[model samples]
Target chain A: MWRGLQVREQSLLSLLLPGLRSRGPRLQCQAAIRALTGGPGPGPGGLRGELDRFGGITVRLGQLRSADSVDPATFRTWLQGKCEQWRAEGRIAVWLHVPIFQSQFISPAASLGLRFHHAESDASLMTLWLGEGPSRLPGYATHQVGVAGQCPSFAQSNNFFVLFSGLIIQTKNAWKFPGGLSEPGEDIGDTATREVLEETGITSEFQALLSIRQQHGRPDAFGKSDLYIVCRLKPLSFRVSFCPHECLRCEWMALAALATAEEATPITRRVASLLLYGHREGFDKVDLTVRELPALHRGLSYKLYHRDLPELYEKMSAMD
Target chain B: MWRGLQVREQSLLSLLLPGLRSRGPRLQCQAAIRALTGGPGPGPGGLRGELDRFGGITVRLGQLRSADSVDPATFRTWLQGKCEQWRAEGRIAVWLHVPIFQSQFISPAASLGLRFHHAESDASLMTLWLGEGPSRLPGYATHQVGVAGQCPSFAQSNNFFVLFSGLIIQTKNAWKFPGGLSEPGEDIGDTATREVLEETGITSEFQALLSIRQQHGRPDAFGKSDLYIVCRLKPLSFRVSFCPHECLRCEWMALAALATAEEATPITRRVASLLLYGHREGFDKVDLTVRELPALHRGLSYKLYHRDLPELYEKMSAMD
Candidate 1:
């Protein structure tokens, strides 16, 4: 009985939406607009999506009523019809948000050439480009990685415990660590050392990653997230030749003084105290050291940042 | 003498590339294509760009001979001509790579509406979208953040020190922590707890961030970078009701056994040892605690992951 009904609907769909019919056997006939909008599917609004800035449509499936309750076959039919309509309307992209509960719809979506762009704990985002060329749809979680170099002055004797600081041209009277955005394919350590050289003309070696700050909606980063990594550096050359465009002043200041200075940023002050602690107690307590490990793919490696394992524990684990 | 020559060149530009004249007062001419391509500008390749997948062109200024030596005025004129040519060919985007040494060209490029996309230590990449709607160009360093929840079993007594482990269906005999990728706008801790509940049907509370791994060129992530964070969790429910699709088997294994088990992945083994160390000494030694800080924008806050400062130091710094 169900087969007969499906065949009748399929014939009707072919007559009504010729675009869907030409998409091969994958296109199945589902309920029409009246059934989708007025019937028991996707709540009162149905599956209508808002137009995005890039001539794409983004449908938030999670917002639909009983989103997960829809049968997979029915959802697939509906999606095929929607695609045909969107393509005819000159839409360039389609972004579908399928909540984890409604993940059954993912297979149907993927079969239609929709690819997984990214997934969150509650849902996964899939995208399809209907444009002439490749999908110009952007990637997920666009983040800018910035590295700050905390270089303590090279101590000629045991008496000095000063730190080198740069006064940023953009910020009034605020002392900041010499740093900049990490280039594509650049390592954290390499970025820290290189930025220190460019901004302050201080050659340095990366010692350890001290802290990480993750912020979102940065105006400078086009409303994307930013990851700021602070690294301890060992100064190779102490002479200051600061870039006039980047820094107003560059000088060595006492760590204690910087820690209490009202002119320093909160992060800089917090790191200053942390550095003081490391100087007194030991660096191992505060440092997140880097180690390279083989990636799942051959000929590729990744960087893992973690607290250094104690010597005794390392030896014990080595026995395995 | 310079002013007279500049006026002549500007008149010639208006006649040759009418598109430049319509762009208003910002457009200025200095040199022609022969001077730009054949002479000292942008090497022998003559400022030519390769077509991108999205009907755009990408010109790497860093690859040019004496790239930084090009006068900004001359480069500006060359850019105007190229833009006019690209527009006529129905190009959708223009990507210009300007090295730090050649940053003088940035002003001219920005005058033409090219905005900063991303930067490396040596160069900055800028882009302009000429598509009908809006720019669909993707963001830099696309990263997917994945979280793994390490949940120890809920012990009824002091003697039991077991940990819940799941055998991933994708890998043969390899036990992994139950976790998933974080959703957009979700916190790290929230993702850990939510994933554990979804995959294992085990309720857990997020404890502390344990480790971080940054890898690049992941096939699963559309050839972008991946940041995997491991978090410690306190299990609320001990029973295992694993999703069959994601796991082959789920069981509670002794920490000592799992730490030495050959079936465990290298990272799993390493984390196990760290957990053991934390269990014996204290979590404070291995944990990177989370703190909430005010973002630069009003009504927004960001998460900072770092080591816990000593109580004495926090108190001392509080005085400041």
Candidate 2:
């Protein structure tokens, strides 16, 4: 009881005397710049706790963990409770800056009209309007898009492109595609091609669409979803350069080798087989209409076209 | 000469009579829907041509191979040739749909006013306003953002998380984080927690942050760049139930075991060591201003935080 009173007394004194809030002597430093919330007047720097701005409180969310009952409903309820508490505190808006990878809370936050405000270098800003009179609430949709390339082997080698981060580092035994996540406003195809080039330093051309897979219920996904697009690409150059920051080395592995490489990811082998050998068994194809021939390959005068697999087969068979 | 003449005659006939272009009968099926570009226009079903909308001709790009020189200047020259050809063909707006992975052409395309047009499910639309008086080409900045989680070991088991996509598929021998790419607008912290939950079905709480890394000159980046944020997370629930579609299984791995695991990525090993043993050798701590804890941790909150290290130190000191 005495400790509780002491805590309350200290808070009361701190609240009444802002200058006396610090337990230690204030250090001499240059004036701190305003946190770019861009609304309301500037405030002091390095001040712990909520900063009142834009008629709301900017919350610094600690690293979030699932509450004991880590289900979707409970998580949402927890988020709702936080909003309610903020509302009761007479805040007009609740601005939360979350890291850009938290997909689980997006939907729940969206439900509360705390939509995406903008993106920083590493985090996304979300704001929930708490004021009563017709606040502007925008609809937002979030998705995890994993962009990877089927860096196919050259026609002669029949090998697919792969990169080894190194035998001494994180991916010692595993080989990965020169692909990663698509950036904001970047095309998925561009992601695949860039990743391959970045990892292999081999400029590749995007070819046919191989397959797109969507899976949900990932732990990191927070019950959201992920979309992965795998493209069939042809290597135009055989340069073996690579960015050391991203990978240690690049190689053109035979299809047979990739299929059996103990270090290859499950998805990599499947893609090599599908793109190189035309083995599209378990996955469905997305029918795309393209200029009968690719722009670079237009010299061959391949007529532009689009067709389902069955129709395409029929046309070839008819010629035969 | 007879065969060549006959082929020429057939081509001439087909060019003149568009209806008779197909050598075989056209497939009698319901008219196909336009590819779900989520834009204006009802195009002819399965017509092998660019979709005409927004006063532009959507281009189908081919698998690009760099010529022997394989420089950006050369690639740009080749692209310029294609653009010139299209200009001659009277295309006003050249709408090229580059995949997200096509980093090689990004700078060159951006320079040609083939800026970001819009996005579809799998690709980004770049519009090169070739026709008309001063077409509005908006500049777009593209980045590949990767969110990884550093799931810290709980008190009982200094066991970091390691997920297996299963023993059968491509990820047969590999272990991965409970994290992947963050969905659009998702917070990086949320990404760490959510991914852990999605892959492991263990609800984790965001703890202190670990690190943020930015890298440039990635091959797939095509001179663009990527930002990766690795977070320190605390698992709330240990019961890990994962979706079969996402992973084979997840296990809590001891820090020491992970440091030596051949398949573990170098980054993963370093992270495990740092989190478990405060191993800060040969790497700089990314300056992330979260709670002052990390900065203090830099200055021996490091000592206050770890009991094992202290006990070991005390034993060594006593021996001394």
For residues A114-192, what per-residue lDDT tens digits would candidate 2 score against the true structure?
6555432334456777878865332222344566665555434434434321111114445757676666546556777
lDDT of each: 0.69, 0.45
Interface RMSD values for all candidates = 12.7, 22.6
After superposition, the stretches of candidate 2 with alpha carbons farther than 4 Å from their true spots are A1-141, A155-170, A215-225, A279-320, B1-320
Clashing residue pairs for model 1: A120-B183, A183-B120
Which candidate gets the maximum DockQ versus the true structure? 1
lDDT of 2 at A232: 61
lDDT by residue (tens digit), candidate 1, A1-320: 33454454456566777776556554233434335322223433266667876689787777766764666567766777666656656789888876544555665677777766654324457788987786655556456678898886534324654343422222444677888887656778998999889888889888888888877777667566777889989888877788886787877667676777777766777787788788889988889888788766778898888888888666545433
DockQ of 1: 0.16
* Model 2 interface CAPRI class: incorrect
Write candidate 2's Cα lDDT for B262-311 as tens digits.
Answer: 56644454445445433222111211212111111123210011011122
Candidate number achieving the greatest lDDT relative to the actual structure: 1
The TM-scores of chain A alone, one per candidate, are: 0.58, 0.44
Q: Give lDDT tens digits, candidate 1, residues B180-296.
A: 777655777888889888787888888888888888777666566777888888888877788785677776666555666667766777777777788878889889887787765
